[model samples]
Target: MNLKKHYLITMIAILILFFSIFSILTKLFLNKGFLSIEKKYKDTQINIIQTLLENEKYSLSNIVLENSYWNEIYNAVENKNIDWINNNLVYYFSSQYDYDFIKILDKDKTPIINYSKYDIDLNINKIDIINSTFKNSQQYTDLVNIDSNFYIISSSPIFDGLGNKAPSGYMIIADRIDTSKLENLIKKIYNFESLTFLSNKNIYFNIKYSTYIPLKNNNNETLGFIKIIPKKDNIKDYFYKIHIIFLIIFFIMLLIFIYFMNRIFETINSKIKSTVHQIDLISKGNYNIKLNSNTNIEEFDMLSNSVNNLSKTIKEKIDENNKNYIEIIEAIMVSLEVKDSYTVGHSHRVANYSKKIAKKLNLKNIREIEVAALIHDIGKLGIPESILNKPERLTDDEFDIIKTHPEKGYKILEKISYMDNIKHIVRFHHERIDGKGYPLGFKGNDIPLESKIIAVADAFDAMTSDRCYRSKFNIDQAVDILNENKGSQFDPTIVDCFIEVLNEDMEFKKSFAL
Candidate 1:
């Protein structure tokens, strides 16, 4: 063979070797990475479902607690006022609480008033289960399976009145954990495609991709399993797309290298070297770098212009991808807000406030801080709407559930590579400088500066916004509250900067005006 043909054969061999290595690495690294991420995503979804179940139990317990501890109910039971029990307790529990079974037992555990939604005879086995588990020292809140159906039962000792310690009898409220209820909760929280509750099967399946999370009772005994059939088009697809893009770029680079090698001896060496350097810059993400080829050869000039045009095209695609990413993030934030109507536009206001504070403090990456502020509450989507929109005060349990939002938000955003920088900020936005914050409770300088800024902004907007339980605070009151807790709940420097920002910016001030 001639020299050119010999060179071509040698280059083809090299290309084949390179392709084999690339394919192996892509499978080992890219596929493995995708599997790892898929596992994490499924784990997150399972945790979310577990949290949702816990919240539902807590909510049901609260409902039962509210009714059981009331004075009127206690008096009605003590007086043996059958009419009062039938009219008030029965109607209220059935209609208002939406409980499937309402049973009021005497101090001796004798059933006084038994009511069921289906008008069937009260299950003697359920009463036995309640009696077996009830402790005089504490209230009973648990999941009980009655005749193959799961129910969340809350049993509280009946007191004579609020703050009364002596128990008269027991008030038990049971709500069936029906498929419809679980589906609704899953839909609200995750928007998952399909969720199945499996019973008495091997919890550990040999399946490669199926997700299985065990459903446990309050006692931590595995009762059943939640099988989540994940949506096929999940976040893994996003990472796969990234890998595909990398593969495409690799091929383009390889072809360019081969083209340059073919012309190495014939073309002006300087021009080929310059074109290769430009390609290197493009590979390094400096897409604006251009080649000034003056070799006077037609091929050299055409190659230079082609490289430049490719750079522009790549830059445009990058810009478009960035724009699309921002839109997706905004859409996610909007979806979270939509779940709780009372907090509509709250995130936007927080972002604006955060940006203003960042500017006032002369902070770097002001845009990133603002974006973090916008998504700080994304975890709130995991919280139940009943707790979020509750017209009354939140119980300590409810508040604890609410506090998990920051961590939930962090878990969600941490999965996206681009969101790594802001994930901690989202997680720690509620952190106090005094180490009293939840999730991690990082104190003072340990909390991220972005988080600190978002905290102040979050607090100000929360206070200024009208909520279901409280009227909107006037600007002065909000400012005074911020000042009161500056060093304790919030970072002092961020607070001061935010206060200055609010005072100087009329538009920002007017935006929060009551």
Candidate 2:
């Protein structure tokens, strides 16, 4: 699933599980509390009953225990024609127990005494409770339902000084047991804002419980269930606080994971860039550059492998062609040299000088300088091999034809796309800064740097090397000639670069031999 849905389902399921467990635990706790309250209620009732009994209130206990006491007392009262009995025993029971109503009855079921919150009566139907009591005892308890109100009637027969514990009428005390002492006890059990609503299946708990209190019965026996619910609004805010805590933790962990993933990807990308740069260089014929691929990464290994393979083929092809192309240039230059071996390595010398001066000038860019030096003498292609090999001076027509070689060579390499830049160098190598050189006769900075490089190299080699027409100048003569013509025939800017190269006494130091 998508991330949102995935997190949504997982978190929702977790929340649901959490709430379910919370609800179950809440129910378990409340049930224990309800049970405890029930037991407490029962215990309190038992305590009250036990206390009254211990205080010699057996008259009331006997009423609760006997059945025929009501009728015996009612009959005795009726026969005596008493309005109300003057016994201190039932009155004491009433005073001690908070009984709202108290009464006595004769054997004929007449009321001996009766008292209410505001009234008194001398008659009651003891026959209504005639046979309900503990066996053979003149005591009884009858549940009376009147006007939809429920009350308990406890009746007991009186006794005389004689050893006969026979029935002698009865006394009754009525008290309301709807007191809310049980609820007060529950309040004590719950936390400050907690409560309960009784229902069949659902319970709500307001607090994460500090303790659980089960209900109790009137006999001090335990009841196992209690319902707890919140009575205030702060509980939801508690969960909100919890959500904030969990959310912060989750995002922090997520950010950490993302950061590590980014670091790993960055490392991978860096490695890939190195591989691409190496492959790109090899593609463009820069075999001298190293792969340095490290060979551990698979793509790097592949790139390194590809470059090595390509270098093998390129090395073979370049090896195959190098002798042929160099021989052709050498053969042509040799025609000049054969006419006058004073220019034995003239082409080679010019190429070296061009490259050196370019390097010294900080025009150290490789490809352009290479192509420029390689074809700097390409214009001589049109020079007649016979006269170029001539040992003596040429006619004016032949000299004009000789000067036309630069323009002619420009046209020769002009159509070859890879060699197009070579033509400019070929065309301007003979041009002079004094506006006196043939072909374009371009002056100063108007000459391209490539052309200027070839110009310096070509002039230096020509002056130092002997020709069929004249003796070669010495190194100092060549240097003086160049210095004298620095701004007039050669660009002084490139001249400085040329001076540095000559001072280096580079690889092609020997002058052309005649």
Candidate 3:
């Protein structure tokens, strides 16, 4: 991965982490908050039940304090108008006080008035408060209905208040709270936003359809659970929309990553191309080429400047080397010309032409060709002037003496300490690739590359320039002869290489005209 890509990825990863943590915290907080509200509502219901019970107690006690009302009913009991008394009392109390029924019973707990007329001889022993009211003549108390609707029965004994144990009769007041009204009130209070349930015994109810927040009292125990089942609310839609938005954000980040990666590769590639071009110029002896300093980067700038400085130093060294090489070649050539004047400028022209040939052949050892061409005739001093200066074609014996120059030059040059590897050219320059022209008659592949190059240079210069007795051939005709004799008098590759350089639009062609 790229450093810039790594940085961007890390940023995205941290952002996701932050969001993940934020969402988790938000859920936890919502859960705790909902539970707190549930506990509050449960407390409110408990308080409502307690207040209603207290109000019931207050109204029941007031009925016991009103003595004259029950005293008038007892007078009707004495009149033996039992039907009138039962109908009148039932109609008065049931219609006025929301009582379920009003009943008047005899001393043996036989009902003299059964308001609804369900049973007259009903056993009321399960009514604890009613038993207390009949036995101890208490004024008002509650009782349970043993064989009736779930009801609250408030009873008062028909007492004379004379501290007597006997009571004339009892006043039974009963009422039943409506179950439908209770259900409607609970649903209204805790509405559609939440699922609310109330259970006295171990019953449970679920109201909503999404997330569930369990109900609890103040003790923090889950009394019942309310489920908000997975459904579509505005909040749910909002979070789902957010998720899609972030997914697109992540995808966009990936595309941006690829963009930066490609940019880095292209930038490095351009820098490499610039470096290669500069190196090619340096190879062509263009040392004046300087690298740009303002590349807008550090490492490439350093590398460019370093190469320019190195090429600059190498050029300076090569200039000094050329000076020494020229002086040495000129001195040796002048001395050889003193003995055989025909070979005076032959070495210099060959050295000059050989450099261009080596370049056209893509040869790396050009210095070897220059050195060999300049000193090729240095060994002609050992040959007799009769054969070297002969005006006509030499006899085989005299020609054999002239051919010894390559080996003689090798032996002489091998003694010079600074010319290491150039001795091969001097010794083998006369050796042909086809073993047709040489002091030793060495064959193809037995020739050194440098020697082959020098042989082509020596032959080309000799043909194009005036010799001791032969007139010079034109450059084009000389080129044709060299090409035609490839693989016989010359190494075919070097002969072709030399001709190609001679035909170039270079300074030599323009300076040296036929």
Model 2 misses residue 286 by how many Å? 8.3
Give a tens-digit lDDT track for model 2, residues 1-514: 9986786566556544544553344334434433443344333333322222222222234334432324444444545545334444445556665565676565544666667653433134433543442234455554343332223456555544331655556556654322243355333322334333232234343324312333332233432323333344223333344334434433443343344443444454465466556645554556576665573544445445544654454445444334433443344454435443434566666777777776777765644665556556555544545446667788898789789978876765553443556668778878888778879778777777787778877887788766777877887788788889888888888887677656676544453323
RMSD of each: 8.3, 55.9, 56.7
* Cα TM-score per model: 0.62, 0.39, 0.38
Q: Candidate 2, TM-score vs. the true structure?
A: 0.39
Clashing pairs in 3: 209-228, 209-229, 210-228, 210-229, 211-228
Candidate 3 residue-wise lDDT, 1-514, digit = tens: 9997797677557545644553454334434433443344333434333223333443444444343145556666544458777567767766666565566765556667767533333355656667777777665444233332234456777655432445566666655433442344334322234333333346444433333443332234444433333334323343344445434544543454345544554564566567656756664557788888677755456556655664555555445445544565565567578757778777778788788778887778787778777887777755655567778888887777788888777765653545668777788888877887677888888888777777888887778888756788887788888888787877787776665665665666755554
Each model's lDDT: 0.72, 0.52, 0.59
Q: Which scores higher on TM-score, 1 or 3?
A: 1
Winner on lDDT between 2 and 3 is 3
Among these predictions, the greatest lDDT belongs to 1
